[model samples]
Target chain A: MSTIALPHQERGASFWRLVELVGCYVLGLLWIMPLLYAVWMAIHPPEYEVRFDLFAPLTLDNFIAAWSAAPFARYFFNTFVLISVILVAQFVICTLAAYAFARYEFKGKTVIFMLILLQLMVMPEVLLVENYRTMVRLGLVDTVLAMGLPYMASAFGIFLLRQAFLTVPKELDDAARVEGAGSVGVLLRVYVPLARPVYVAYGLVSVSYHWNNLLWPLVITNSVSTRPLTVGLQVFASPDQGVQWSIISAAALMTSAPLLIAFLLFQRQFVQSFMRAGIK
Target chain B: MSKLSRLQSQATPWLLLLPAAVLLATFTHIPAVTTFINSFYTTPRGARPARFVGVEQYQSMLADPVFLAALKNNAIYALGTVPLAIGLSLLMAIIVNSSIRGRALLRMSFFLPTVLPMIAVANIWLFFYTPGYGLFDQILANFGFSSTNWLGSPNTALPSLMLLGIWKEAGFFMIFYLAALQQISPSLAEAAALEGASRWYYFRRIVFPLLMPTTLFVLVNALINSFRLIDHVIVMTRGGPDNASTLLLYYIYNTAFRFWDTAYASALTMVLLAALAAFSFIQFGILDRKVHYK
Candidate 1:
C-alpha cells in the first residue's frame, strides 16, 4: 500500500520520522551497548572502574593479557580451519545430494529425504553421548577433523541448495546435454552458478552458526589446537578466578568480532538469509 | 524400481548420493544405534569398559532427584523462552511493518544480539546480572531500586536466563515474521481499510491468518532450540541456583563430563532424543494443520 502512506499529511510523516530516528538511535545504542562496554572495559585498566569517565586513556594491556591467557592464535586458526573444512565438505556433499533429489525421480526418494530431514530435528548435539562414543571409537577425539566430520553432510544445507537447484529450468539441462555435457557437467555449469546466491546465503549462515556453536565442539575437542574461539572464550569467561570482568569481556569481544563485523557490514543480506533460514 | 536397469539408470543418482548417505549413516544412523545401546549399559567411569544393564540407567535416571530437577527446569525454561520470544518478535515485526522511518536501522539493531556468540552474550548478560557495578544493578541503584540477585536467587535464576534467551532470540524470530509480512499483499489490507475496518480488526482477520504458517515454523524452531541450546547455560548459569537453571541437555553434559558417567549420560541423551521426537511430531502435526488451514 504505497497509497496508504502517500496521501498522508507531511506533518504526520515528519512526526513519525522524528520518532523513528530517535527510536533508531536509542535502540541501536541499547542493542550494541554491551559490545561498547566491552570495548571500554577492554581498553581501560581496572582503576577506571565504571566511573562514567570518558576521558580515561586506552591501552593494549587487556588485549595482551587476553592474548597470553591462552592459545588465542591457535584457537582462532582452528576456528578458521574448522569453518573452511566443514564449509567445503558440506558444499560438495550437499550439492551432489541436492542435485540427485532435485533432478531425479526414484523410489524411496520421499523416505530418504524424510530421513535426512530428521537430522534437522534431532540435532547432533542432542545425541552428543553416542556421537562422542563413535568419535572415540574412531580414535578421532580431540581433533579438528573429527569436529568437522559429523557436519560434513548437512540436511539443512541439502534442503536449501535443493530448493535452489529445483528453480533452474530443465531446458537449461537439456541444452547442456545437447552441447555434449554429461550430468556432472550440467550440474557444475548450469546449476552451481545459478544457485550462487543460495550458496552465499547458505555459506554465510553456516559459517556464522558454526562459528558461534560451542557445545558440539566442547564435547569433541579437548586440546587447545582443536578448540574453537567460542570454547576458548569459555575457558576465559567461565573461571572461578573471582571473575575478571574486564578481561573476560575483552576476550569475548575478540571472539565474537568476526561474525559481528560481518553482520554489521552485510546487515541486509544477513537479515535476509536469517529470514530464509527461519522459513526453511 | 528398476533392478534390471539399476546398473544403467540408477547409477548416477546413487553415485551422487553415496558421500552424503555414507556420512549421515556413519554419523547420524550409527550414533542412533549407539544411543539405543548405551542407554542399556552401565559404566563406572567414562573411561571404564561398559556392560549391558538393561534400562538400569534409565530406571535410576528416572528416580534421580537431579534428573527430575533438570527436567523440571527444562520444562519451565522451554515454556518461558519460546512463548515470550515469539510474542515479542511478533510485536516487533508488527512495529517494523509499519511505515516507520529508519526501519532498516531498527531491524539491524534488533538483530545484533543474534549474531553475537551465545557465550559472549551470556557473559555480557552475566556481568549485567552481577551484584554491583553491573548494568542492571547500576540502573536500578540510580533509580533508587535496591538491586536484586537476578541470577543468584533460585527463584529468579531460570527466569533471568529466560529473559536473556528472549532478548537474544526475539530479533531472530522477528526476521521470519518480517519475511512473511512482505508476502502479504497490500491490496488485502487496503480492501479491509476500504471497508472502514479498524487497523486492529484488519490485522486480526487478515495479518494473523496470513502469518499462521510462519508462526508454526517459529514455534517448531523455538521448541527445538529450548532443547538444542546448551551454550547459553554453560556461560550464564551453569545450571545453578540450587539446580534451578538445570536443563536436560545441560544435565546430560554434567553426567558425561562432570560426573564422568558415560552410561548415565547416554541414558540422559536418550531422554533428550525422546523430547526431540515429541517436538518433531508436534511440529509435523502443526505443519499439516497450517497447510490445511492455508
Candidate 2:
C-alpha cells in the first residue's frame, strides 16, 4: 500500500528523520572514540601518547616495548590453550547431554533437566570459594586445566545444542538406524552435522568468554606460566608499575587483537551468528 | 527389541548424561552446597583445624563497613547502569533499525565493545581517566578545565566504572532489541502512519508493548551482569580509593583470596547467591508467562 501524505507531514517526518540520523552519527563516533584513542596512542611515540597531533610521526616502538615488558608470549599461549580446552570439552560434554535430552526417554528426566538448568542462574563463578577449595583438594590448582574445568560442561551450550538437535527430524534417526548406524553413529553423522551452525555460534561465544575471563583464573593461578592474558595485563598495568600510556595501550591492543581482528574481518558473520544464536 | 537391547536403551540416556552430570555436580551443585556450609565455619589457619562459627561470619558481614560499602556501591552501580543501559540500547536499536545512512557502520561501532575483553577495555579507560595527561583531561584542558582524578577519587570512581559498564553493555543489549525489532512487521509502522500517529506515539503505544518479552529478557540479563561484570573493577580500581568502586563480586574475591577469609567470603557469596536466586525466580516466572501467552 502507498503511504499518501500531505506535504507538511512529509516535511515534519523528514525533519525528525534528519535529527535522528545526526544523533546516531554523533553517538556512533562517541562510542568508538575509545578504540580510536587506543589506536592513536599505540601507534604514537611516548611524548605524543595523549596529544592529538595530526602529523605525529608514528613508530612501532610501543608494540616492541609492550612485548619486551612482560611475558606476553607465554600469556598468549596460555589464553589460547585455555579457550581451546574449554571449547573442546564443552562441545563433547554438551553434545552428549543434549542428544540424550532430545532423543531419550529416561527416568527422572524432568528432574535431571531442572537440576542442569540450575547452573544457568548459579554459575560456577559464584561458587568461587568452594570451587577453589575443590581445586586445591584435587591438586589441580595453578593448572590450566583448573582454569578450564569448571566451565567445560556449560548449561548454555547444552541448552543451545538441545534446541538444535530437537529440530533434526526423527526420520533421519530412523533412516540412519536402518542403514546399520548405531545410536552414536546417528548422532555423529546426523545430529552433530546438523547442529554445525549452533556449534559455530556457541564456539565463538564460549571462546570470547573464556578468553576474557579473569577473576577465577586470577584467584586460582599464582604463577606467570598459568596466567592468561587478562590477568597478566592486569598485573602489567597495576599502578605499582607506574603509568606509561603508549606501552600500556599497545599491550592492551596486543592482548585483544586476535578477537578484534576476527570481528573486523568477519563482522557480519560475528554479529549474525550472535543474532542467530538467540542468546537473549 | 531383545531384552539386552531394552536394557541398553534404559541405560543409554544415563550413560550419555554421566559426564555432564558429574561436571555440573562437581562444579555447580556441590560448590553451592559447600559454600553455604563453609559460611558457617571459621577459616582454618595453617596449623589449626576449622571450627564452627554458627552465623558469626554472617554477623561480622553485617558489621563490616567494607562489605556494607561494597553492597551499597553495588546498589548504586545497578541503579546507574541497568535502566540507562537498557534505555540507550533500545534507542540505539531503534536508530539502527530505521532506514538510516551507514547503518552497518553504526551497528559495528556499537557492537565492537561486546567482542573486546573487559580487562583490555578497562586498560583503555584507565588511560582516559588518568589525571593530567589522560585523554579525558586532554579534551577537558582544551576547554580550560582542570584535570580530575577519575579513578583515584572516591566521588568519581564508581561513576567512572558505571560509564564503562554502560559502554560495554549497551551495544550487547542492542543486539537483542534489534533482533526483536526485525521480527516486528512493517505493516505496524505503516498502519500507525496511516492513523497519523507520531513516531514517539507509535513507539510508545505499539512498538514498546510488542517488545515486552525482549525487554523482560534484557532486564534479567542486565540484573545478572550488574553483579557479574566486575572484571573492570578488578583491573581499573581494584575496589580502591577507600573501597569506593568495590562491587559485590570483587569484594567477595578480595575477602576470599586476598584476605584469606574464606568464611566471611562465603557469607558474602551467599548474599550474591540470594540476589541471583531472586532474579532467577522473577526471570523464570515472567518467561513462563510469556510462553503461556504465546
Candidate 3:
C-alpha cells in the first residue's frame, strides 16, 4: 500500500483490463491467424485459396493429395522412432542419476552435477561442427539413431527428476531399505511411482521438442527415408518448384496433428509440464 | 539382509550416475572434444591430413563479412525478441492474474501458438507473406499498397523471422510469468487497492518489484533462446538472401556443413559458449542478490 503511487498512474487495471480484453480478442485472433490460415488453405482448392470469399468450397483433396505426393507414412515412422528412442533413453538414464542425487550422500556430487549442468548451457546446437565430424568419422550420419543419440543423456531431465525425488521423505527410503529392498528396489517401487508427474512432464516436453525439431535432423539426414516430418516438410516446401501451398499445409497438419491431439487431450498437463520444465 | 562390503555400500550414487555419465560422455563430451579438435584442422573434400592450420581459420573467420554479418543479425534478433516477448508475457500474466472471465480460454489462446510446431507456424506465416496469394499482401492490396517482398529481401528477412519467433515464444514465456504471478501474494494487491491504488499503480509499485526475480529468469531464458534458437531460420531462411538471418547457431551449421569450415565453426562455437556462460553468470549474480527463494 505504501509503495502504491496513485498520482503517478498513466493506466490502471480498469484501463488495462479493457485494454486486455480488446488485446485478448485482437491478439488471440492474430496468434491463431496462422493456424486458421493454414487450415483454410488445406481445406480449399487452388481456385478458392486466399479468396477471403467466406463461401469458398472446402474438401479433403489437400490431405489426399499431400499424402500421395510424399512418403509421409515413412516420415511419420522415422519421427516416431526418433522421439521414442530419445524419450526411453532419457528416462532410464536420467532416473538413475536423479535417484542417486536425490537420496544418497556422495563426494563431489555438486561438482559432478555442475559438470552435467554445463552441457545444458552449451547445447549440442552450439557444438554442431565437431559433432558432425564425429558422426562423419563413425559413419552414423543420415541415420535416425544419429537424430536421437545426441539428446539421449538429458541433464535437464535428471535435474527435474532429482528435485521431485528429494520431496519424498527419508523415512520412506529408510522403510524400503529396512524391508530388505535393494537400491534398485527402492528406486523402482518407491521413488519412481511418486515421481510419475515429473516423468510425465519430462516425457511430454521431450516428445514435443523432438517431434518438431528440424535443424539437427536436417543436418544429419539427407534422404527422404531418414528424414523426420519437420525436415521432410521443409524439403517439400522450400523450393517453389511444383509444391502446392494447400497440400503443404496438409502435410503440416499431419506432421503437427499427433502432438496437437495430445495437447488437446492433455492441455492442462501439457501447460503444467512446460511450466515445470521451464522453471527447472 | 547380509551386509555388503564398505566399497559396494558406498558405490550406490556412483552407480546411479554411471549410466548418464557414460551416455553424456559418448554423445556430448566426446563430440564437443571432437568439434574442438576439428576446428584446428582443414577437413576439405578428399583430404586426409586436415592440415593443422593453427589459428589461421580463426583469423579468416573473424575477417569473413558473412560471419560478422551473421553475428550482427543474431544480436539484433536477440535484442528484438528478448525484451518484447518478456514484456508481452509480463503484460499477459498481469491481465490473466486478475479474476478474469474465461481464464482457461485466455490461457489456452495464449498457449496455442506454442503447441503448433515452429515449422508449421513458419509454413503458415510464409503463406501469409506469400506475394500474390498471401494474406498480408491481400490486406495490403485492399489498402491500395503494393505487396512488399516479406521474407525474400535481405533487409526484412531477419526482422520477419523475429516477428514469427516472438509470436511463437510469448505464450511459452507467458506461462512462466503466470506461474511467477501466482507466487505473488494477492493480499499485497488488495492492500494496494485499499490504499486507493489503481491497477497500474499497484502493478507498477507493488507487483512489478515482487516480479523482478521472475523477470530476470525470463530475461535469461529469452536470451538463451535467442542465441541458441536457430532451428527456425534453418527451415525458414536457410541463412539465405545473402545470409540475412544467419544467427550464431545457423552460421555454425553453415560453417560446419555448408561451407565445411569445421575449424572456424569451432571458434564460433566457443564464442557462443562464452557468451552463454557470461550471460548465465550475470543471471546468477542477479538471482543471488534479488531473488528471495522459498
DockQ, all candidates in order: 0.55, 0.56, 0.51
Q: Model 3 lDDT vs. the true structure?
A: 0.80
Q: Considering lDDT, which of the candidate structures 1 and 3 is the better prediction for this target?
A: 1
Q: In model 3 chain A, which range of ten residues has the least summed lDDT? A: A1-10
Ranking by DockQ: 2, 1, 3
Q: Highest lDDT: give the candidate number.
A: 2
DockQ of 3: 0.51
Q: Kindly report which residue stretches of model 2 are placed more than 4 angstroms away from their true locations once superposed.
A: A1-9, B286-294
Fnat for the candidates in order: 0.62, 0.64, 0.56
Q: Write the per-residue lDDT of candidate 2 for residues A59-110, one digit (tens) a residue.
A: 9999999899999999999999999989999999999999999999988999
Interface root-mean-square deviation, each candidate: 2.8, 3.4, 3.8
lDDT-sorted candidate list, best first: 2, 1, 3
Question: Which of the numbered candidates is closest to the native, going by highest DockQ?
Answer: 2
Model 3: share of native contacts present?
0.56
**Candidate 3: Cα lDDT at B23:** 70
Q: What is the lDDT of every predicted structure here?
A: 0.83, 0.88, 0.80
lDDT of 1 by residue, B1-294 (tens): 578766656778888999999999888877887878877988755476777789798889879998999998888888988998898788677666677666676787778888888988888778888877788889889889887888888988898888888888888899999889888888877787667775567777778877888888888889989988978788877888788889999999888877778888888888888888888888777565645335
TM-score of chain B of each: 0.93, 0.96, 0.92
